[model samples]
Target: MSDASFSLNGTHPTVNWLGQVRAPGTPGSLPLIRQTVVEAAETCGFCDEDVAKIEMAVGEACTNIIEHSYSTQPLNLDIEVKVGRYDNRLEVTILDYSSINFAVDQMAAVPLDDYIATGRRRGLGLFIIQSFVDKVEHRFVCGQGNELKLTKFFA
Candidate 1:
């Protein structure tokens, strides 16, 4: 586990700039990442159910990075996570320093009925993430790394 850095930035006095966390690209760091996101959501006045959804979504994303993005390389790299609170939504940005270019467009939607009927236990990370979050955006740069931004609007 690593120390998380928090800051407060806003044009007005009521808003806050949640925090940022950097954890090793491994399954062991998921709990911390999830906890940080949960806290940010709660602080931003998200309900319990929504907070749970956000936690699960963020966890799945980090898991995908660890298992797929960094699979070929060593586990020494770090996954940077930033949580922010806006007027009507909460945003979470996950950055991975893997050199592998993940083909986000190539991910096809999973048929839930058949998937469940077959008792499949894998390959649903992106589905869960899309279902849970209000918006999902990802981009990969040649040398910058991969960035996944998830946003959940307040209801």
Candidate 2:
């Protein structure tokens, strides 16, 4: 199926922040995403530290989405962040037509001890992301793009 265009949804109570971009996926999107998501979360009452973490983690997740999810005229991705009172969490979901193939668990259990032992300075994005988020989930279509869900809860 063709990717859908990005649109504003004004009816979702929980959708405090959302944005979609079709530009060429690049490293530069990282900073832009971090700033936008964090600013929006702060507006919704997320703590400063929590906001910073969420921004960083979400930026990493989005980078993964862009790099791994779509190919050949990439599809539009939907990002939705809901800031709640009890949880004060940021929920991010990516939409596309590609099947889900990324694994957060595999990424989370990074064998940090080995890395530390070797003093390796790589493969830190996933590790950093797991440290920030309380939960990460995956919803995949049979032959469609995967929805990568990332959440960061503020304490």
Candidate 3:
């Protein structure tokens, strides 16, 4: 929990629990990231099922950052994770620093049925993430970095 601030619309504070993790952008660092997110979600009163979903969604985001964005290089970049509990919802953001040019916001998850038909062993990370979370938002700042925002509402 550094001196970083969490604001929803860039005006007011939105996060109740704020945390940041600096890990080598590699697959070996994913478990640490997932553990942190699960703990945060649990503290926010998320049920077992919802907690598992959050873990998987955040893991998917981290996997992408490791495998694609950072190219499995040194984990020198700052990978930030923020967990915020709203009145009726919980929001989580995963930020990473990378130079890879990607349009995650404009990409659509391949349909599950189609994915299954193709018999591809991998490539459903984003789809699984989108299916579990209520909302997913992606943003890439020109000089800042990439942000993958995940939101889940309590029922």
Candidate 4:
């Protein structure tokens, strides 16, 4: 775990506080990531319900990286989660170092009504994440890694 304060681009506000956690990209690491995010959100003055929502959203994002992004690789890569507190929102960025570059735009929306009616149990990670967070952004660089940013505005 680490903490820092830094300014982003001119268009964005400077992050008031930032903390990060890195763990192996495995199911076992999800709890640690979720707990760290929850603690950060609470410290940022998020309400109980909002903190729960952020927790779930970050969990889903990390799960996708572990299950999909690192699925093909044999070794366990590290997943870096950065929690940043801005003036209006709490942002959690999940980074995976896998070589796989997933198409975030190409992820098809799940038909919630049909999905629930069919009694399906899986494939709703993205939906849950989008529904919980105020904003979601994905970026990937060839040599760098894929970063999924989830933000929840303070109410």
Among all candidates shown, the one with the greatest TM-score: 4
Candidate scoring better on TM-score of 1 and 4: 4
Model 1 per-residue lDDT tens digits across residues 61-141? 899889988888864889999888766889899999988876453466587887798898898887788888998888899
**For candidate 3, what is the TM-score?**
0.84
**lDDT per residue as tens, model 2, 18-130:** 44333334565566656656665676577778777777777777776667654333455443333222235556654445455666645555766877888877666787688
In the predicted model 1, the residue pairs found to clash are: none
Number of clashes in every candidate structure?
A: 0, 5, 1, 0
lDDT by candidate, in order shown: 0.84, 0.60, 0.79, 0.84
Instruction: Indicate the worst ten consecutive residues by lDDT in candidate 2.
Output: 78-87
Residues 67-138 of candidate 4: C-alpha lDDT, one tens digit per residue: 888988877799999888888889898889988886553476587897898898888887888888988888
Off by over 4 Å in 3: 2-14, 72-76
Ranking by TM-score: 4, 1, 3, 2
> Which residue pairs of candidate 4 clash?
none
Q: Which of candidates 1 and 2 is the stronger one according to lDDT? A: 1
For model 2 the TM-score comes to 0.66
Residue 135 lDDT (model 4): 86
lDDT of 4 at 131: 85
Residues 1-155, model 3: lDDT tens digits: 74344676777645566455667666778888888888778877889999999999888878878778877545467677777776677888888887665555567999999999999999998897888899988888876778888999888
Model 4: lDDT equals 0.84
